[model samples]
Target: AAQTDAWDGVRALRADYRTATGERREVVLGDGTVLSLNTGSAVNVRFDASRRLVELLAGEILVISGHGAGSGVPLEVATREGRVRALGTRFAVRQQDEYSTVDVFESAVEIRPRDGSGAPLLLAAGRGAAFCRHASGAPHAVGAYADAWSRGQLIVDDVTLGDFLAELARYRPGVIDCAPAVARLRLSGVFPLADTQRILNMLPNSLPVQVRSRTRYWVSVEPAS
Candidate 1:
């Protein structure tokens, strides 16, 4: 079953904020930083004299550095893999099971892996990087629509059905099985994420696939009969 509750216990006990499945929220920190929490996301905020830390316990978050009345303290977003220290920039950080990805939209950020073996890297604006506990990948160009989800939209460009569903699944509960038969079908659009079921129903209008639901919690996309 698909679920984002792995960090539920930690979130209940320590998280400063979180968003449920299919829900998006924005939070303002003490230092004037704005945090946009994506679906199924949880975070814990720790502000001290030395630094400001927003520990991502699960899912994704978009951070906009604030220039508020608070004192100047470095703001960082930490995942299980490593820490992303903001350089007076705007960025989004996503936490996955094996690695974490950072998309920098403005200014730059310093990525420091949890393990000491790999050297830290300075990623500039308009670039993205994926890093694990021990090493970081080379920065690559990223699309401007990286933060589209914050606006309750999913903008895909000629992506495979399987890939698209994999991302859509992040916003809902239960399994969204894309049968291999129809997985290769491509799609592109600006779909409203407010209603995922409506999005699923609209797929057949563009692709050669049919959506079947055994229950609200189980859905499969297969080749249209």
Candidate 2:
């Protein structure tokens, strides 16, 4: 956690995350693959005229298949939760706190929990899952988080405000405190990065809590009356 290099290998690099401002960077693996990293995210490359590998830290990222690599050429991601294997597809891997999510946009990926276990969990398109860091375990869904990054949209059914806020905070950096009184409230809407401020402004209209900004770098939810 002290001063150190956040990146490794020439194909991958880590953007600066020191200024409390989310940072993003791009990398082109030796195989002509393009990668777009998100805020507070970092990656390591594993390519040397043989295989292709990438590792992700926090935030979101988009991976496009690169050519000049053989069919079934391994495109793997290492994270705090475990290892993810891509299968001729586009995918995004996120590691936030104790939670790690893999959303496959195309094809499938095999997840081998960093538990050092030999077997792995297979994830197909349109389905996503979460892993618990302590136990090297994860849940299965039919790719629910599939389009979280590529599509830039979310489809939530009936869920508590607390759950929704917890999910929304993944995209934004820093703190987003929600009051207990309004955490149970339920609502649904679409929020894009371009309209994040609008989303912040709209929250107070429905709940009794006000969304106050602290220097625009942090936010807190508090009782309105």
Candidate 3:
């Protein structure tokens, strides 16, 4: 589930860490920075005399800066949207198709948009924000359970069935189609990501929907007849 690839480039040694679907991994970089990757996550790392940089290519990661070989230099994590400069802090970053989300758990972080158009924004602890190439949203309070997934649990509070399934899909393989007719049903609970099948099985007992599995790779939810 965890793979490491390294190669020497013209400037320095570059390493790539990736986690497969349904897998979570933790990696410690040469500089002592710890990265906890979520399912289907990947991070490319490079360190030199000048600076330390981490490129988040896909999925989500929780970063904890460590005092190690390269601890003197500032560490930056970049996504397509922009860059997040860690200020001796712990934070989480998640990449989307057109944007990226950053949640600050301790201390603060400085965000700079990729387009270089807007002023850099400072996000403090207990805050979360989203940004794209052109714009960044205002910082908002992070939910208490925002970091639950890192503990192998998914916690939802009055979330629609559709929204919850979309999130669950990230930790699962293949497709899980939720019918529009049942998408608006609301539910709240803490489900263990390690046992996805158990969560699917319990859905029928709580919600007025039926789970139909055509194959192990394909499943659907529809209104129970």
Candidate 4:
């Protein structure tokens, strides 16, 4: 039944996984690394005697390394920009069109730019950095509500309304446009990911914006009339 179907799904995604829009997925690698894929993400896993790697094809992922510091086989997550070698860590990687971002949560990681222009950065826990093919930016403290999506929550603390809408759009299938007039409005809350429409419905209650729905697949947040 459900469990059997779930296993079948896992087998199909072991080597390569591409989540449908609004869908999230989790996979366990042979070495016991746990990967949590965010909406619309794609990844491929490659493991050999000498190395274990996960290629992030699209979107974002949260990884918990299975191997310890003493383990001979190394675990790394690769994006188009470069590879993030996990130093026995828990971290998240987001592959954007122009650059890739990494947030170290538990231990540490080494960010190596694909072009190798500069020395690789050693990012410790509680820090994050963004890297392009040629360079990586200085590490910054992790955001207040970072990686909350992995736990089926979208926690916002004083983020702009536009930013919140952008994140909400990831878990939803349609376009959620926030008007410029309301884009800068401040928002802070813990919104559940299970029912995204409910989140939209409640937004007007807290903010001075109206949720205009042309269809379930299309929505607009406009300044209240």
For model 4, residues 69-151, the per-residue Cα lDDT tens digits are 32478799998789999988999999886789999999999999999777889999999999998999989999867989899
Instruction: Give the per-residue lDDT of model 2 (tens digit) for 1-225.
Output: 122223321223333321112344566666767777765566666666556777664556777777755434787877767878888777778776566787777889888877655567888877677765433345456445445434555546567778877766765766788878878888766666434557778877776778889866587777786
- Model 1 ranges with Cα > 4 A deviation: 1-9, 12-14
lDDT of 4 at 154: 95
Model 2 whole-model lDDT (C-alpha atoms)? 0.66
Query: Which portions of model 2 show Cα errors greater than 4 Å?
Result: 1-28, 69-72, 132-139, 142-146, 151-155
- Order of all candidates by TM-score, from best down to worst? 1, 3, 4, 2
TM-score of each: 0.93, 0.74, 0.91, 0.90
lDDT for model 4 comes to: 0.89
Candidate number of the best TM-score: 1
lDDT, residue 221, model 2: 72
* lDDT score at residue 15, model 2, on the 0-100 scale: 30
Worst 10 residues of 4 by lDDT: 4-13
| Each prediction's number of clashing residue pairs | 0, 5, 0, 0
Give the per-residue lDDT of model 1 (tens digit) for 133-165. 888998999876789999999999988999999
Query: Which of the predicted structures, 1 or 3, would earn the higher TM-score when compared with the native?
Result: 1
Candidate lDDT values, in order: 0.89, 0.66, 0.88, 0.89
Clash total of candidate 2: 5
Encode model 3's per-residue lDDT on 1-225: one tens digit a residue: 012222212112223887778989899888788999998887888789888999887789999988898789999999878999999999999988668999999999999989868679999999999998877898999988888888899999999999999998898899999999999999999999998878998999999999999899799999999
The order of the candidates by lDDT, greatest first, is: 1, 4, 3, 2
Model 1 misses residue 72 by how many Å?
1.5
